[model samples]
Target: MKIIVLTSWLILSVSIAFSNAYMPLKDTELESIASQFPPLEYLNPLDDGGLLQPFLIVRIPGTENSTKVQNHVNDFFIKQISQGQNSSSSEIPMWKVTHDSFQDSTPIGDNITFTNICVSRDPELAINEGDKARTRKRLTLAAHYDSKLYPEGFIGAIDSAVPCAILMYVAKVIDKALTRKQAFLNENGVGNENNQLGLQILFLDGEEAFHEWTSTDSIYGARHLAARMENEDIENVDGLIGSGLSSIDTFVLLDLLGAANPRIPSYFSETHDLYNSMRSIQKRGRNIKGLFQHKRRESNFFSSPSVSENVHFLGGTLGDDHTPFWQRGVPVLHLIPNKFPPQWHHLTDDVDHLDLRTVHDWAIIIAAFTAEYLELTNFILDQ
Candidate 1:
């Protein structure tokens, strides 16, 4: 995790917009999304083939371990999700995988290459010639895939390992729902309305600083990608000219998660309502039986709106991967805890220190949140 500082300039300078009302998923819809797959299927530490186990290593930038982890993410999206799907066939939904690789000088006086793996399932991305869907909005979910350089063997389980695995799980669960929705629309001979939002999952590299935290050293991948996307133009299908950055509805960055009894506070006032939506999702999960196996002795994972509202004026937002995007006018929902975990940046931050119950519950909460955000409830229920 990058060092957090309370900068008043950052709070006053970034753009703010009124958040729209989020439609709360019904109880049955919540249950259906939660039960679509086992919450622990990808997060289980004992399962070698699962997403979590492969990330339990020291993956510093430009290292062999980092390449291995990057390949794992690529394989899941390319081979697993987009394996048999024919691009010519609109009935089958496919994920578009792209890599943003660049090299820069580090604080250690060495230049190394870093790659950001981006996988997206845009409903309107590529269909038949006449049936091409125009990409409108995307709910971008992101997390860093690199560990700190100081610790020789730091696994960074809670630092970001578990958060990366959680994203993979979310993508896998939502892919099925998306496939069904596309198939249903195709069968009914109905086009996807302009309101349908796309899902993009980013596995960023070089989030950690080589030596100490600084403006240039930390968040290497985010700074590079944000600048690149700002200028890169997407192929216009509906005569709409927009950069990749403009298409993002919201950028949700998860960090320092997977610890037991974490208190995640809402930082920006603009996205507080979106934060409340997540809080509402977490509250609604309690109503579904067996959704949360182990209850935290402390407060819920999300701090109450009443309590978090005060944090807006305190300038308590952390300097993280979202900083670059937020500076570029992106509405960011930073989901890191107010207080860093005790095991943060320590050798004990390995897999043994992770809480299975907290890990499992977070997977469900985030999965449910994504389902509602993408409006997958109607399609998932149809399945």
Candidate 2:
């Protein structure tokens, strides 16, 4: 009897330990709080029903501005793709764009330029909202915006465009919900409110630098952005560093997210932080009596590479845009689907081949994580 009792106690202790290691999703009550976006159902052949439309640009000037830029970039893609446009490419290009504004002398000096490129709904959404004014924690969502260079008739849909759209949608949902939550609290005479977090959506250029994957071919923009963010010391605000505990907060990179019944790889230790954040959102959604709740299972759908944890490219590696950020030690949660999508790099990656449900789920997960992180940090909520 004593042995059985001790064994039961040990099991209970183990369960609790594991539970403490991670947060749980809310009470299985995910409700839809988003507006019915028409683009979600669009099917025009002109631009793959709008998937090829380019939209959004987010700048993380310093660590303080990272999160907002990340979220903004995330939301921008979500809205663009949800409204019917096929996501063409999702990359955060960090480059130097220099133009000589003269006819006499060579352009003054070479300027390092970082322009995020992703096909979107329209240019209007790309515009930056006026400065929020406070020192903020920053995070980046990097993806390529250009579709594969398949035959001219091919849409190259799965190559990357779909993932970009999903990121944009998630950002919008989180931002919109926060805005509404504050309003609701105000309406109910609640005394206090939290500030909003920022997210930058970096749509990269030259990801498929060459036709195939070579050391020098892919990750053109990512390399530039990573170098710049690490090398530059633009601000004097000491408070911003403290916001992230004097470390880079997070850089969630999205890739092959449009495949049907996708499976995310449980490949990195850093991903647990992100998973915990998502669970927090699920909980908050339930606690606040909101629409968001247990819509996803937190466990990763796939396993990490069998060969080497440090080596990103291995026997069964799926090389997407997550490499550069990981190289910089910025904790990247790369969201790649089960396997490379079949329509990838092909002409058939059109509206018909895409899966709307997968896109929707992908957007939700991103939103959940953002909301949870903002809440847990108490940075946005401390307002």
Candidate 3:
């Protein structure tokens, strides 16, 4: 009799504890997430010089009618963020150097036929700034913008297109916050002393592939960049954090976020701090809404508590863009949406598969972290 009573009481306690811990996302929050990426007045149909025109179907968010509007906006941001290709920049060196063009170098001694090869500079130049109290503390949000190699049908919207767009929102917000914080500090007489904290919004160029997946095929761009940063001469770099919205920081890549709210695997337990950060942001978003009840609220998709203890093994192939950084001892937090999008790797992966609320929620989380890392508070008060 006593055993039976104890068991019942134990079950009741467990149930009550779980009930108190769980919190469902509300409608207002969803609306807030949708608003993060406002719809575009116009969209192109191809990825051109920084302007992306998504496939009409891929642009729509959700599998239902209710999310159409938000999906359109999300699609716009994703499309627009891929405006620039691998262009030459002094800030970040492009290692491609051609000694003799195909027209210049050549077929040995016989005819002197020109030959060209893409050569990478001996991974120098970009180095990590020594770990500083403020500098060593960084949260890097990385995403690859390139689509996978498939027929015209594959736009890779779910694979990584959405993640890239979301990263940009984070980049912009953090950039703004950091700049403001810097200004604040200066105005208030504080200088670079506390200006070391930073957030690197890394938009990798090639995460997809041309041929087989090898060190040279996928993640070439990010790998090359990270290698350079590890060169020991770089300055002002610290810790690293990678983020995606589809899945929590379990490092599980999101292949299909455009589907309905899919089930996320039990992967968050593998990466504790990152999981904590995700939950923290979700909590913050909820708290903000609760506090400003009369005002507006924001939607956050990553609000649930993760209960899995699954530790994801680094799948041999550095699946996404974050793989390279993770390889170099940099901590990575990958955020892939649940399940594979129906249009994944197809022309169908166009705008229709996008969700504005998803993008918006992602943007909020990114913004929060960027603000935290960059420590932009100095700008406000100093300025």
Candidate 4:
């Protein structure tokens, strides 16, 4: 009994000592990052007959385009991985990067490929190159890469392309924060507990059903991946450092973003704090110029809102990508527009339906909340 108590106390002390380790990224840096975007190069793609088409149709699992997009995102993650591994501590690319891949035949009748791109310092962490140290406390940013079906080609710019791109951009902005944290730990000779801060950006395949939205059709990738995690005994619910428990502290799913009118509500009671954090970040972003010009809605059940004509609050989950993880008891924060645009799941859900400013605000707010949750701020409490 005494030994257990002593161990617990020691762990607490170490945690507090490293509590101040995380560093907050500045809004100015975020603005600079946002400014570099309009990176349309990633958007336009070859349709057919040697012509480029804006529409991205249902990239079904195991198909050429599906693999191409997966490899693209995986390669995007690897660029930073190479930078970090090749460079010294001073040059530890803005973000520590690595990834994991899951492939299997799903209940939906097709073999699927799911790739989870990570920005982290977990020592079993493998870049596209190889593995590193084991992972620790994690915060994940998730979105599906596959666009839904439409009569005409479907780009799904708002359906999810913007959200996926936003995660990539957020990962880019977060690189600085991760490196800054690493730099501090190195200079102070603080044990690399900050390595526990994990950032996972998942570009899930097969989010759109091959036929229709059904238990057997939709989320082919997520269902397989979640089951596999459980099978491997990787998920840890009450541990500070382990495989899956440390692999993901919270899973945040972003979908249907970058539309003109946006309304995100606190979907799950358990994830309310994280949801509120996004809201807090939203309010904070008001000072950041060129961010969130459109009026946004918030759902605070506890307090009465200012009865303006504009009101935003969601009562329950939207049954998007977070469904599988949420059911498995993984903490989930769903960031989806409550009032989905009329173009949702339609051929018209293309760039013409997207707002760059909305994209910027979504990226920044999510980045801010993620920074806060990871304790990446220099402001350590008086523990």
Candidate whose lDDT is highest? 1
lDDT of 1 by residue, 262-328 (tens): 8887877777778888888778778688677654435488887668777653223467998888888
Candidates sorted by TM-score, best first = 1, 4, 2, 3
RMSD to native for every prediction? 2.9, 14.0, 14.5, 10.1
Off by more than 4 A, model 2: 1-29, 34-114, 117-135, 180-197, 240-248, 276-318, 376-383
Worst 10 residues of 4 by lDDT: 1-10
Q: Rate the local accuracy (lDDT) of all candidates.
A: 0.78, 0.42, 0.38, 0.55
Candidate 2 lDDT, tens digit per residue, 16-105? 011112223233313343323223532122343343333212221112232333344444344432343222332211111121111111
Top TM-score prediction, candidate number? 1
TM of each candidate vs. truth: 0.90, 0.57, 0.54, 0.72
> Taking the tens digit of each residue's C-alpha lDDT, what string does model 3 give over 1-383?
00011221111111000101112233343234325433221112233322224322222111232133233334433333323522233122222222211111111122222111122211111222333221222334555444554564456655555555454444433333344443344345453322432333443444555445554455545555555455534322223332221111112133344333433333323344445555565565555643212122233344344333344522222255555445444444445543454565667666666654454444555545444434443321212
Overlapping backbone residue pairs in candidate 3 total 47
Considering lDDT, where higher is better, how would the candidates rank from best to worst?
A: 1, 4, 2, 3
Candidate 4 segments exceeding 4 Å error: 1-58, 80-133, 191-195, 234-246, 290-317, 378-383
